[model samples]
Target chain A: MYVAAKGGEKAIRNAHALLAKRRRGNKNLPSISLAQIAQQLTLAVDRVMAEGSLYDVELAALAVKQARGDLIEAIFLIRAFRTTLPRFGYAQALDTSEMLVRRRVSATYKDLPGGQLLGPTFDYTHRLLDTSLGVADEAGEVDDEARQADPADAAPVAMPRVTDLLGQEGLIEAAPADEGAEPFDITRAPVSFPVDRSTRLQTLARGDEGYLLALGYSTQRGYARSHPFVGEIRFGDVEVIFEAPELGFELSLGTVQVTECQSVNQFKGSATTPPQFTRGYGLVFGQCERKALSMALVERALRWKELGEEPGAPAQDEEFVLSHCDNVQATGFVEHLKLPHYVDFQAELDLVRRMRAEQAAERPADGIKEAAE
Target chain B: MALMARAEAGELEAVLAGFAPLPAASDLKPPEVGLVMLRGRTGGDGAPFNLGEATVSRAAVRLEGGASGFAYRLGRDVKAARAAAILDALWQDEARRAEVDAALAPVRARLAAEAAQVRAETAATKVDFFTLVRGED
Candidate 1:
């Protein structure tokens, strides 16, 4: 005899308990602290903050630990939490030229003003596993000279950028500024056709990392190849400002670490406009430079509208890329088809039955004609 | 703090009290109502195709509070119109703001409690594991 299933709520509760027990693994062991993860797994924290669109490093670390290192799940958690937070105010537009330089480099020039500072990068390191690091513990020992260094010695010094040099020589086109222009907010409002540059960059910043990476790689493989050279990549902290209603002028709110990228691309002028060099801009929260640089190159490719260039490739088509870029919406729609749809199935069945009966009646007449022949 | 404005309770009551004598939907002469056919496109820039007709109702009213309210309801509802007019008066009257906030207290509390519950349940599942090595000679 068949029995209908019941106790769904109870079953879910029991399953949750089992999952909690499994995650706890050996209760006798010491518990990991949020501080340790924030310090040791800094790169993972950076990725979480970048995708989550949250500036708080500590909160990102907590989400990572809670999600058990599933970056996407952590991002979902952060987004959900962020939605509940009320809109307090808007921050003042940051000036990238005034950024306190930590790590700055340029590919267009071999050497420039305020010489290259390759601070704490793994670019030149060999990809080899070190066996000694597994059991090494040098926690308490500290060098006296390094510890006694003056606090002023560690302060960031302002460095001149390479792109400014090009701007001075008139080699690169002057940066355009529309101070009175309104910027669209992608989070609060739905995306419409012919989006502005700010909204496009916002979408790309929160876009799926893997999807953007593949799209970027396709360009390199000659899909919509635009010759791009890294003008400059800088990482450091910049002050955020917000204007108070009572106060006429803007005031400093706080500071946030950011990575900014500028890419120079070759553009032959159109019939009406003179030929000049163009540029692409990318800015992301936290210490993520490579992704930011890739984003800048892709952004330039998408700027076919303002640049008056022909839309000949995937990168040039704005609607096609932005519409299909979001992972959350894609995952939901794809997965939701698995839910029950008995009524829809019944309607399809009725249509099929009526069509088959008509076909069956015509089959005998066709057979009789063939026999007569 | 500068943006905050004070709203009192008695002023809200007066606004709500004035709305009780408005003409009912059935009593007022029925205005012209019709259905407009909406066209749907196959794709974003594809050819246009006929979808279906949607019923829309619109009404204009002058309140005793010296403010006119214009409403467009998706479906035909006489009671909804009367209620909407009352709401429009309360919205236009700055003095009724405090009373409106007081009326919404219960709903806001419920939503906040529900959000807190969800946060607590999610936080409870978070677990961290670590390994410690003991030194012995």
Candidate 2:
């Protein structure tokens, strides 16, 4: 008895039209430029880029603009764009030690070798939104300082790892990379069960930051706790290097800003290896400190088996965490329910109506409507 | 090969246009262009994070003489993408390399000139920092 509704295409088209109209919002007002989004809404752009698994500011800004400030939608747009691109070759492994340090901090030691630089952080800033920021000129001294690079602002300093001190006494795990091993390309292959550490890390890298943060928070609430110590947290620019086949040598491409965290966790010994502390690492594009730190925590928590610890919680379960980490996939699955389910619902509707009519007939016909029992 | 890094959409198309009597290439895969999310790591040994997305166009073509060419370039320039693919196939055919190179010479020259222009502009603002030795030292 359910009538099939039509005009889905028309509805979608109209909705898109409405969205565009609202996106412009009163044409008299000046439009928001992509450059403005890239510069002003930097955190949003960074998040979109991180989640989208792309790293161009201008394009991210354009995505943000096209998506009308919807971060997830912007990420989707980037993903759609990324789907068609041809693969260039991969680059050599990046070295955090060579990073031109902008912001560096360590929670373990009171003092570090190169010293702690707070840099541009919201840590101490009052959360109160100042009215003055709403105005361009009122924000005080809109200068060229932020636009230009200054060597005098920050020296390229590489601080010694805080774990090195503890490691001297043989108290930390030595996490060595397998040289000359090709990392699993998650993009190229579907997610397999019991994924390798490289794939796990790669998936986690682009995983939703909020979800990871929540998972990390759950760990702090006594869910597979890895009593973490910040060995060093650094934010800075690092040059990209790749082997140029034509040149027959590795050449520097350019530099990109990144945030890295090396979290030293409690020491655990294997049967063969003596008691040594292990480190969870987090590295992300641009200046997303929270994501980086959360990644390290979640990464450390995921290392339960390698360190011989019991996999006790959700975060510890690699399959559960990795599978649910992608927001794009989760969002799509959840949002798909809003689409037409008329035929399926009509079957349920018919069944319910028939049951009701049968019950009515039985009750009216006789008091012989006794329970089956 | 040299143009891969620096060539944008317009320049690539202009260069591709130089091959006026464009050689017919059998479509192995028709050109498909889309944005790709760019990712990077810290210093390079770190967790990968999205830097941003870029438009990338790719095409693969096979020449009549059995040479195959595949091309990949940044941004959404399908014409340029197809041309590059054709040239790539032509390049593989030893007889066509010289002709292709000749056709692309102006494009390279233009790129070099533009690069030089940028260098000139940068040099205009070039500041050389100097060390002043202190008497105490």
Candidate 3:
């Protein structure tokens, strides 16, 4: 009797069991808790949240654990989970100005109204490994000097933005505000041609960090090269507001931590437009400042339309950049080719074979004679 | 007998009162409608093929003041077809529009609430990332 694939199900079950056992490793080793992962590996949680387009640290931590420390897998899990969600009311346009400034810095200015608060950045930290940290148990208390250095005690002040300073002196043209225009929903609606600024920014916010990094790097190396300066980069929590149907206006619902970047680019004078500095903006969820800044630079490069520049290069073309930007869609389309396609492939093979036979028949009799000789 | 009972109870009159009669219905015979082909797949497993067409009946009723309603269903059941035609007529009727809207109100409200709940659950898990050096052994 032919026993056809009797052990397939059993083999699959056994493999799954083995995988679970391997993932756990030696039981003696302390299992990593979700809280510990969230608190200790916060950057990974931040990346998962940023790319996954989810904000919950606990969920991100759980995803990291479930994915066996694979950040991409964690991101994929979050994205899949996000699709099941339905959109309620749109949040009121975020006011970045009112953000409780955590880390705010302007590369364009040496001194600003609100002095540069370094916050908790590792910009100047030495890359040396601290072996002593493994033995160190007791956490140190805040000294009197450190307490006095805290910027939180400072008065609530509305600092003039560095970009505004340039606009004040006519170094850069004022950004046109579209208060009436409704921003397109990138999640629900399919992204079509001639995308608006809001839709473009939304796509960039959830874009793959590595992909954007490579593209941004390419731009720096003279691929549609545009001289850019980090105008301002800020990371902090901003309140999300939404309009209730009963209430005519808007009200604050909750807050989300975001990284905002504004990149200033050098603009040459066009025939109709005068020479003035143009701006690129990137705002992403969580504390991914580097990714946000890279996104901002790429965004400015993509703004060939408003800049009155011809789309001769890849970066200058909006359709090219936006179409190929999403990693999820790209990965899905690429991997889908691996699915069973023997029938379609067989049809193509038959067509090619028939064509070759027809071509051979159509060839000269002399060619056949020469081959025979 | 049922038809006679309905006519005696003024049910047909009440249905007609809801909408202005269609210009085409002036003729004694009921209005003619066409079937829409229903496309479906065949084969238990492996590559599925389109399994031939099925006949469907469709009708449209236009009320006097420009409002219109449509009805469509598989197969030709005369009574069901007539009932559907009457429903279309009632839907187009300006007098019964408020009733139709009231009937749909609860369903629409439920759908909206479900959508809002889905959004809340999804938004609750949004995350952002920061760079960090991984611990080395």
TM-score of each model, paired residue for residue: 0.64, 0.71, 0.64
Candidate 3, which CAPRI tier?
incorrect
Recovered share of real interface contacts in candidate 3: 0.00
The reply for model 2, stretches above 4 Å from the true place, is: A1-6, A140-155, A161-169, A244-248, A354-373, B1-137
- lDDT of all predictions, in order shown? 0.58, 0.70, 0.61
| Candidate maximizing DockQ | 2
> Which portions of model 1 miss their true places by more than 4 Å?
A1-7, A137-156, A246-249, A337-373, B1-137
**Cα RMSD over interface residues, candidate 3:** 22.3
Whole-model lDDT for model 1 versus the true structure?
A: 0.58
Best model number under TM-score: 2
Residues A294-338, candidate 3, lDDT per residue (tens digit)? Answer: 888788888877777666767667787778777777777877776
Candidates, ranked, TM-score: 2, 3, 1
Summarize candidate 1's per-residue lDDT along A194-219 as a digit string, tens digits.
87666677777666667676776676
A best-first ranking of the candidates according to their DockQ comes to 2, 1, 3
Model 2 reproduces a share of the real contacts of 0.10
The C-alpha RMSD in Å for every predicted model, in order, reads 17.9, 9.2, 19.2
Rank candidates, lDDT, best first: 2, 3, 1
lDDT of 2 by residue, A253-313 (tens): 4455678887888877767988777888777777888998888889888989878897779
